[model samples]
Target: MSTVYLVGAGPGDPGMLTLKAKEVIETCDVMIYDYLANADFLKWCKEDCEILYVGKKGGDHTLPQDKINELIIEKARTGKTICRLKGGDPYVFGRGGEEAEELVEAGIDFEVVPGITAGVAAPAYAGIPVTHRDHTTSVCFITGHEDPTKEKSGHNWSVYGQSNSTLVFYMGVKNLPMIAENLMKNGRAADTPVALVRWGTRCEQTSMVSTLENVAEDAAERGFKAPSIIVVGGVCSLHDKLGWFEKKPLLGQGVVVTRAREQASGMVKTMRDLGACVYEFPTISINPLENADEVEEHALQLGRWDWVIFTSVNGVKHFWQHLRNAGLDARQFGGINVAAIGPATANALRDRGINPDFVPKKYVAEHVVKGLLDLDIAGKKVLIPRARVAREILPAELTRAKCDVKVLPVYETTLAEESGAEIEKALEEGRIQYVTFTSSSTVENFFQLVKAEKVQDCPHVKMACIGPVTAKTLRDYGLTPDIQPEDYTIPGLVQSILDDK
Candidate 1:
C-alpha cells in the first residue's frame, strides 16, 4: 500500500528536528512543506528530492487546503515516498486532523510523526517549564483561532476556566481580545499571568509578560508577530527566574576562528558550551603536498636526526601517512628526539603512542624557534616536516645553533568553497547574528566566497576578527571589526566577544 508521512517540522532550529524525522526526510522522494517550517531542516532532504511549498504565508495562500490534500493523495497513488511536512505538531494548530480525516475517508494509508509543538517548545527555549510541581498541577492546550464560519458564540470558557489548569493557546494573537474577555466573563481571573512568545525557539525569539486582561495590548506594544504562542496561568510568572537561554556565556557574542577542521573541533565545542554559536569559515583548507618522494625515501633516516619536529596536527598526520605509505611506523623514530610546536600538535603525536620530548609553552612559530634554541642542538641533525605556509624561523634558528636542519613541506593551504548564498540569505533574513574570522586568510577567503555586491546591503550583523592580521583584512574589505582579541587564540577570541557584552 502507498503511504503519506505527515511529519512535524519542529519549531525553527534544524537541530530540534528529531533523528527519525531527519532519517525519513533524507529518504523521501518528495517533501511538501509549510512557510513556517524551518527551511534549514529541509536541507536534510536528499539532494534529488522534489520540494513543494503547500502552505499559506502572510495573506497569500500558495496552495489551498483542498489542493494540498489532493496533491498528497495523488503523490501517494504514484507509489512515491511522499512527506507532508508541517511546522510544529501537526495535530496541534496545523489543520492536520482535518487532512488526516480526509485521507482516512478516501482510504489512503497515512502516518503522523509528532513534532515538538511551539507552545511547549517556546517556553522550554525560554527556560520556563510548562509544569511545575509547586505551581500548576495540570495544563490545558487550547486554540487561539476558532472557525469563523462555525455557528455563533464563544467557546465554553467555564469548562476550562474553572479547572485551574495552565491554559496554552496556539495561534491566539488575533483573537486574544475575544478569548480574554470571554474567559474573564466566565470565571477566569483577569490577573491570571499570561505571556506572548514570538519566533519561539529561534535566535530571534522575543517574549512579553502581562496579565490576562491586558496581555493582548502588551503583546502588541512589544510587536509580537504571528507564529507566536500565548501561555496563561501561574507557570508564566516563573519565567523571570527560569529564563536561561539568554544567559549563555556568549549569548549575543560573535567570534571568527580560523583553524583547520581537525584542529578547530576542540575550540568549537568549547565556544558552544560557553553559549556562543561559532560560525566556521575555514580560511586555509589543508591539502597534502605535491611531491614527497624525498621525505618518504628518508623515513628510516629519522634516527640520523637529533630531533623530529611537528608544527601542526596536519604536519603530524601527513607525515604519519607518508611513513605508513613507506611501510614505516612510530618505531622508526627510536633514537630520535620528538618535538611539537604546541600542546595540540603534541597530543596528535601522543595519540600515536609517540609522546614529544619537548613542546613550546606558547603556540606561535616564533615561540617554537625560541624554545628550540634553548635546547642544545649544536652539531646535531634536526628534521622539520610541516606545511608549505609554515614559518622558516624554527629551521633557521636551529641552523644558527650549528645544527643541520632539513625542512620538508608536508601540506599546502587552499581556499574553501564560496558561501555567497549562505551569507547573503543569512544577512537578508537576519538568521546570522554574528560572524567570527580566526585568520587573515579566513577573513579574505570568506569575503572571496561572499559576493561583495551584497555585503554593502547587509544590515548590522556584528563582525569579529580573531587578531590584528584578521582585523586589518576586514578593514581592507571595507568592513570595520567590532571585536579584536589581544591574544590570537580561539579562547581569546571567544572571550573578546563575551567581553564586548
Candidate 2:
C-alpha cells in the first residue's frame, strides 16, 4: 500500500524547506503542489515523477478544493507514493485537515509534514520577532480574508483586541481597512504599530510600517498588493532597528549569471547570500570531449611530461576523470610538476591530493606563461589539459622557451540551447542590475542570446567580468565592464560588487 505525505513548502524562501520535505519530494512518485509554493523546490523531484498543479490563488483556481481532494484519493489508489505539497504549515490555513479527513474516510494511509508558516517567518525576515520577550509573549495567526458578511464571524475581534498579543494576518492587504477598523472598534489602540511585508522571505522582500489608524491609507499610497502579511503590535516598531535582510548591499539588486549551470552554483550562492536576487542564465554548457582516447593515452604516459598545466578547474576535473578511467592515479604523476593558472584551479588539484608547484599571482594567460618561464621550463616537456578552444598564448609562449608543448582537449564548451526568458525579461524591465560573465565563452554566448543591439534597453545594468579576458570579450561587444575584481575569481567578483555598493 502507498502512503500519502502532505508536505508544507514553507513560506516563499526555498532555503526554508525542511529536510524531510525534500526527502519526501525526492522519493515521491507524484506531486500536487500549490501556486504559492516556490517552484524551485520541484527540482528535487525525479525526472519521471508525475506532477500536478492544483494551486488556487484568489479566484484563479487551477482545481477546486473538492476536485483536489478527489485527485489525491485517486492518485493514492494507484499504489504509488503521493506528495501533496502545500505552502506554509500543512494545518495552518492550508486546508490540510480537510484533505486528511477525506483520506481517512477513504481508508487511505497518510502522513502530515508541518512547514514554516508565512506569518511567523515573514515577520522574522522583516526583522520583527513574533514573540519578543520585552514586547509581547503571545502571538496569534489569523486569516484577514474571512468573509465579513458571514452570519457568524469565525474570529472574535473583541478578545483579540483586548489581549496583549501580537496579531499577524495572512492575505490581509485587501481587507486592511476593515481589519483595522474592527480592531480599533473592539478596543485595540488606533496608534498601534502595523507593518505589511510583501513577498516575504524571498529576495524581493519589502516591508512597510505604519500605525493602525492610517496603515490602510499608507499601504494604498505605496500600492502594496496581495500575498502580503500584516503584523499589528508593538513588535512592528522593532523592524527599523532589527531589519537585516533588506539591509544587505545587494538586497534588491537583480543579477544575471552567465556561467554554465553546473558551475554557477557557487557564484549564485555568493550573490544570494549578499542579498541579491540572482538569475542563472547559463549561456555556455560544459561537456566532456567526444574522444577521450588522447586524454587516456596521455594519462598512461604521464611520467614522460616534466610539467602538467591546468588552466581551469574543469581541466583538473576532466583530466582526473580520464586519468581514473585509465586506471591511473595521482601516483602516476608523482615526479611531474603541476602548474595551475589560479587559486581555484590549484585548489581543484589539491582536492585530488596533488599540490600544484606553481599558481600565478594573476589568473591570466600572460601571467601563466611568465610564471612558467621563471620555473626554468626551457628543456621541459609540458602537457596542458584544457578546453578544446582556449587562448593559445600559454602554449605558444611555453614553446618559445624551448619546451615541447603538448595540448590535450579534455573538455569542450558549447552555447546553451535555450534562451533564458527570465533573464531576458529581467533585463528588458531594467530589473537586472548586474550581468556577470565568468569566461570569454560566457560573454560571447550571453551576447548572442541578448543581442548587442538590445543591450541599451537596460542602461542601468552594469557588467561584471571574472577576469581581464572576459572583460576584453565584453569590450569586443562595445561594452565596458563596471566591476572587475583584482583577484580574478568568483569571490573576488562578488566582493568587487559589494565594494562598489
Candidate 3:
C-alpha cells in the first residue's frame, strides 16, 4: 500500500518548495492541491497522475474540510501514492493537524513534509526581518481568522499587544481594522510600523507600509487583497531601505516566450530571475530530420569538402549526431574548414571539439555569404548542413561566387500545437505585457496560434523581437515590434524590455 504524504507548498513561489516535497510530488500518483499552492508545481507530476483540486478561497469552499479528509482516506485505501499538497507550513494554521489525526484514525500510513511558512517568508521577501538583534529577538505567527465554534476568544489581546516579539498575521486583510484597534486599545503603540505584502515571494509581489493606526485605510486606498502577510513591528520600518523584490525592473510584467520547449529554459530563467512572470507558449518544435542517411553520407565525405558551414545550433547538434552515427568524429573535420552563422552555433561546434574557422559578425545569411566571400573559395567544394526549410540566400550567394555547394537537411522546424488557453486568457485580461520572438519561425508560428486581430486589440500588449530578421517577420504581418535590442541576443532582448520601461 502506498503512503499519503501531507506536503506544504511554500508561499506562492515554486522555487521555495523543499526538495523532499518536490520528490514526493514527482513520484505521487495523485495530487490534491489547494488554491494558494502555485500551479507551476504540477508540471513535476507524472503524465498519468490524477490531479484533484480541493481549494478553499475566502468563504467559498470547493470541498469542505470534512469532505477533503474523507477524500484523502478514500484515495489512500486505493493503495496509490497520494500527495495532499497544502499552502505554507501545514502545522502553521494550515489545519494539517486535523488531517493527520484523521489519517491516524483511519489506519493510514502518512508522512508530513514541512514547508516554509508565508508569515516569515513573505515578510522577508518584502525586506522585513521577522527577528533582528537591533529590533525584536523573537517572532510570533498568529491567525487573524476567527473560529466560529469557540464560545469565546482564546487570544489575549493585551498580552500580544504588550509583547516584545514581532507579530505576523495570516489571512488578516478582512479583519485588519478590528485587529489594529484591539492591538492599540490593549497597549500597542498606534504609530508602530506595519507592512502588508501581497502575493508574497512571487513576481507579482507588492508591499505597502503604514502605521498601525492607518494601515487599514492605506491598504484600502492601495487596493490590497487576501493571500497577503501582515507584519507589525519595528522591523517594518526598514522596508524602504531593505525592500528589494518589488523593485525589480520587470517585477509584475508578464512575458510570453515563443522558443521551442527544449530551448526555452535559458530564456525563461533569464526573464523570471528579472521578476517577469514568464508564460512559455512555444510555437515551434525542433526535431531531427526523419531520415539522416543523406546527412550521414555527406558527413562520411567530410575530407572531400573544403568548407562545411553550420547555420544554427540545431544544425551543429543534428549534424554531429549523424557524424557520430556514421562511425566518425570531429577528427574527420581536420581536413575541412568550418564556418558558423553566429557565436551560439560556433560554441555548439566548439563543445563537440571542432572550433569553426569563421563566425560572421552579423548573425544572418547575407553576413555568412559576405564572410565566406573573404575566404576566397572560388572553386572550393562546400557543404551546408541546416534546417529542412530555410532561406536559400546563403547557398545561392555561395554558388554565384563560383563555389560548388551541397545543401544537406540535418533538422526540421515545425509548428507546435499547444493549448492557447493561458495565452488567450492573459491577452483577454490585458495581463500579457510583452510577446517575445527569438526567430522568424517563432514569429510566424506565434501569429498562427494567436490571431493578429487579437494581438492588436490588447493595447497594453507590446511585441519584442530578438533581431532585425524577427522584427521584419513581424512587420510582414503588419505588426511593428515595440522593443528590439541592438545586441540581437536573448540577454539583449531582455535588456531592451527593461530599457523600454
Q: Cα miss at 489, model 3 (Å)? A: 1.6
Per-residue CA lDDT of candidate 2, range 403-467, in tens?
99999999999999867566777778778899888888898898788777666666788999998
Residue-level lDDT for 83 in candidate 2: 95
Query: What total of clashing residue pairs does each candidate reach?
Result: 5, 0, 0
Query: Candidate 1 at residue 167, lDDT?
Result: 82
Clashing pairs in 3: none
Q: Model 2 Cα displacement at 283 (Å)?
A: 2.0
Please, what is the whole-model Cα lDDT of each candidate in the order they appear?
0.77, 0.90, 0.90
How does candidate 2 fare on TM-score?
0.95
Off by over 4 Å in 2: 147-150
Query: TM-score for each prediction?
Result: 0.81, 0.95, 0.96
lDDT score, residue 14, model 2?
Answer: 83
lDDT of 1: 0.77
Cα lDDT of candidate 3 equals 0.90
Global lDDT of model 2: 0.90
- Decide which is better by lDDT, 1 or 2: 2
